[model samples]
Target: MDLHPGEQILFAGRPSWRSILGFYVLGFLGAIVVGAIVKAVDKTGSGVLAFLVIFALVLLVGFLKRIGTTYTITSERLHIRRGLLSRSVQQTKLERVQNVNTDQSLLERILQIGTVDFDTAGTDDSDFTFSGVANPDEVVAAVDRAQRLDPPAAS
Candidate 1:
């Protein structure tokens, strides 16, 4: 993330590892099933290899998704950045932030990870979100602090 000359980062983070727990669980189970099928068919014990390859691919995808995305809160803006090689950035001024909402399923609540959605004034884009963040309440607090501490400069 690049900061402006006087900008200060209030908070910066990536999605939590726990957020990909479901993917890992499903991937492991799928690998086991595929491995068993391959072993039963070939009788060469290649099922182990199949399982390892499938599980490795799943892990790689999950790792990339988690690592490639970033959420940042600064004294003057809120930013969401995605992708590793090719990048996309979305930001809104602190003064434009109208609402900050959080969503957590029962499992997510137990895991202490959730999604934070933002509503910015005059923006029709509803896809602005910080997904799978740990301690979403802290993110909200950071936004509030940023807005409070450094009020937007007059136009």
Candidate 2:
């Protein structure tokens, strides 16, 4: 994570650990219930094996996705970097920011985690989504403050 000249990070964080912990709790419980039903019906262990395989793959993906992602808000821009096997970096200048929004689904609200979305000027779609981050409103406020700063003139 390098910054351009004079660029300073205001807020930097990854997704909440609480959400991942909650998901793991629910996922294991659901898998146990499903595996139990499959075990009763199938004489062989094929159903259990299948469930285990799928569950493992899902966990692997979630783990990689969670660990590989980084979200950053800086004085000049909002930056997102995602993925390990395949990487993508996206940045939107603060001066171009049109709107800032926060969304929390029922579960996310309960968990006190949500996504902060950035809408940059001239883009119909959201420019960035800082998902599953804690204190989304705080992040939104930081972004607002950053956007208020007079953007440096482009060379």
Candidate 3:
């Protein structure tokens, strides 16, 4: 979606490769299992096609998800858009942001990718989380600065 006039985007990002690595791993292991089963049972490569089909499906879904999901930070708000066929968009005003956090697991820390969480002032829970973002500390800093900026209405 286009931003309103006078609004400037501070940051735009997607979930990092770390977030979707599971899908690739699943496809790989599944193909191996299918190959083993076919080797043991058919020997004609009957289930080989099944493995290819499953792998293709998983790969497609992962690609589409990575391509379709986006997290955007604007001077006025934080916006997240996700979905392939149907888009879901959520935005919280900068003035409402209560806290910004970056979370990283041991593996993620090693990979240098993390999740950025945003908690708005009135919300009991985080308004949104950008998972597996590369260099999430920078994003968190940008979000913190944005949160400190006055909202359009206030200005």
The TM-score leader among the candidates is 1
TM-score for every candidate vs. truth?
A: 0.94, 0.76, 0.87
lDDT tens readout by residue for model 3, 1-155: 68887788899999887788977998889877876787688877767776887788888888898989999998888888999799898888887877788899898888889988887877765548887789999898888777676667633
Q: Where is model 1 more than 4 Å wrong at Cα?
A: 152-155
- Winner of 1 and 3 under TM-score: 1
lDDT of 2 by residue, 19-78 (tens): 586667767777777777787888698668857966786687678778888999899888
- Window of ten residues with lowest summed lDDT in model 2: 18-27
Instruction: Choose the strongest candidate by lDDT.
Output: 1
Candidate 1: residue pairs that collide:
none
Q: Give candidate 2's whole-model lDDT.
A: 0.82
Please report, in order, the local distance difference test score of every candidate based on alpha carbons. 0.93, 0.82, 0.83
Clash numbers, per candidate? 0, 0, 0
